[model samples]
Target: MFNKHGTWPMKSSLLTRNVIILSMVSFFTDVASEMLYPVMPIYLSSIGFSVLLIGILEGVAEATAGLSKGYFGKLSDNQGKRLPFVQLGYALSAISKPLLVAYVFPLWVFFARTLERLGKGLRTGARDALLSDEATAATKGRVFGFHRAMDTLGAVVGPLLALLYLAFRPEDYKMLFLLAFLPGILAIGFTFLIREKKKERPGFISKTKFFDFFRYLKESPSNYRKLLVPLLIFTVFNSSDVFLLLKLKESGLGDTLVIGMYVFFNLVYALFAYPMGSFADKWGMKRIFVFGLLVFGGVYLGMAFAEQIWVFAVLFLFYGLFSAATEGVAKAWITNISHAKDTATAIGTYTAFQSIGTLMASSLAGLIWYSLGPEYMFIISGIAALLIGLYLYFSKL
Candidate 1:
């Protein structure tokens, strides 16, 4: 029932001006981020970072982003504004790219990475709230799904750009990091095109305590909690995708092929995100999400046994489907169940805990990878996903 300018003009078209512009912003930002993503692990390895250290770096960075998401999300709600947060967040992220190579010290690398993720934290709730405000319960899937598709399209272009560059100059990661800044700036520019509807502050302004966002869980409807519980549980088993790339590398694939697989996975993701969202709307968000989990279970289980390059390709293909099915669909599902006023807070709190879960997941996965081979890690994750999928399928929620 939220509409930006009064009545919803989106009955005929879901891709309103704000959604397109925001999606463009996401598209460019992702381009910047993903350009570095496929190379990060390899670059760290070249600079003497062990797998364990990499895990810790990702964990710490994500934790920073996660915690800030809650605070900033709550702040946005209190202030009844989204544009400033979105603008500032993208600006921080835009500048953080070139800083990645400003110095090669491990602490500096951690600092730069955390700064970038912090930007993500700053904007996630506000940005998503804007998207939610543009759509109704009926169209949340298409709106979010379209945004994700556009965002992930950048994921495709980014690595492909990196791959092309690396093809010419194989180890020039620093220069590549510097180049990523261009797309980031473009993303920032797109942010200016976005205009939010003015909203009055609630009668009860929430305090801006760092952990205050967590209180929403108690206040939220049962359905919100029910949906979140299984998703968060699933997140614990789902480590960073970096681990997947590293696994391919450990299996003896070269950098180019590893990155290529990543690109292909994203390509599949970009292609299917919108369609999957439409499917969620037509069928049920919960049903599509459960199906995505089943696909994820299959992909990981397949990764457990696969040794051939072709096998890995097939798995990555399915992995993309898993991403398509779940990512935006989950957000749409949450927005549907949450109170409209608390849109940003609901997502921020969920994502903050999700970030914490990611920290745990990445750290745990790293420990498992260090102790027992990747096979065991993949198997454990696969089994856990399958179990969770079944549980969700049977649950009444």
Candidate 2:
């Protein structure tokens, strides 16, 4: 069992200071990120960028983050360090957020978003690996769930802050971007305080050959083909949240109201995350995960046909609940199948595959939305989700 200090121990508290600190870090960072999120698409549209460009931009950003996560995670593990990378990633994202606001050009916005995603890619695997290290086996579900809850809590508060700012200074997006810097800096500081426990390193491994890394993953029973197949299927239907946001816009909701609805979604996510995780722990991870998949499919289908803003908002809330049921719990499930030493690598691999899924889904959804219209995109996504869910159910994974 892992302890609060990220070492093996017989007994430990579910709510440790490190967990709280990490939660604070996530909270602040989400606040910074969320402030810019709602307006970004509108801002791009305002600047005369097409939906296709938006699709490409979002896809590339996510793919970059997803692909790099494993590499950075491995680097952190190899160096026996996490704080420096974590701090650097946060700093880069912090700098990028303000830059996007200051430089309103479309290409500049793309670069800024890409840089921010790069920071995310750099930090996520390492950070989650650290959380796994810090959590005891018995409370892993709750600990990860709590972290996600806190993270989404930040998401909840962030939009409200943005809403408040927009209320007074509606056009000053640049100011909101500038203000985002404060929380990121605080996150960096908190990262520095996190303690890294020592672990025995295996013999020297070459980093240049990427194929060898795949071979390593394949050879390890702890993280081989068994668990990966189901996850891959599930991810194929899991597109970017941008689609859902666009669906809201399609429902004829105003920008402020759309953001308010998003805030509501995060509120539901934050409220239910821990309790759902505990329930998953009791029932089974696979069971809850499959349920989330089904819920996601149903929500997408609802988005396709729903004409009312209120209906869309409720669907969004259920979408948040779906997230609460899965995100961290899925990671916890991965950790259950992986050994401590390769925790980051396994997470990185999982994230990398997830990125592939996002890239495919987002790019496809965008094309469908532009060519066939919004209705077909959700219809296809729902169909894909149903197929994946059926596969999971039958596979019994």
**Among these predicted structures, which one has the highest lDDT?**
1
Clashes of each: 0, 0
Mind giving the per-residue lDDT tens digits that candidate 1 earns over 142-164? 89999999999999999888888
Question: Over the stretch 1-397, how does candidate 2's per-residue lDDT look in tens digits?
Answer: 2454543255346666667677778989998888777767776787777988987888778878887876777677666666677777887888887787677687898899899999987888778887887776666777788889999998988878888888898777677888988888888788877776666666786663332335446655643466677677767667778778778777778877777787888999998888777877788777787788888889989988998977887898889889998898888888877777777777877887788877777667778999999889888888777777677667745
Give the residue spans of candidate 2 off by over 4 A. 1-12, 44-56, 101-111, 208-213, 222-224
User: Which residue pairs show collisions in model 2?
Assistant: none
Every model's TM-score: 0.93, 0.89
CA RMSD of each candidate after superposition: 3.1, 3.5
Over all chains combined, what TM-score does candidate 2 have? 0.89
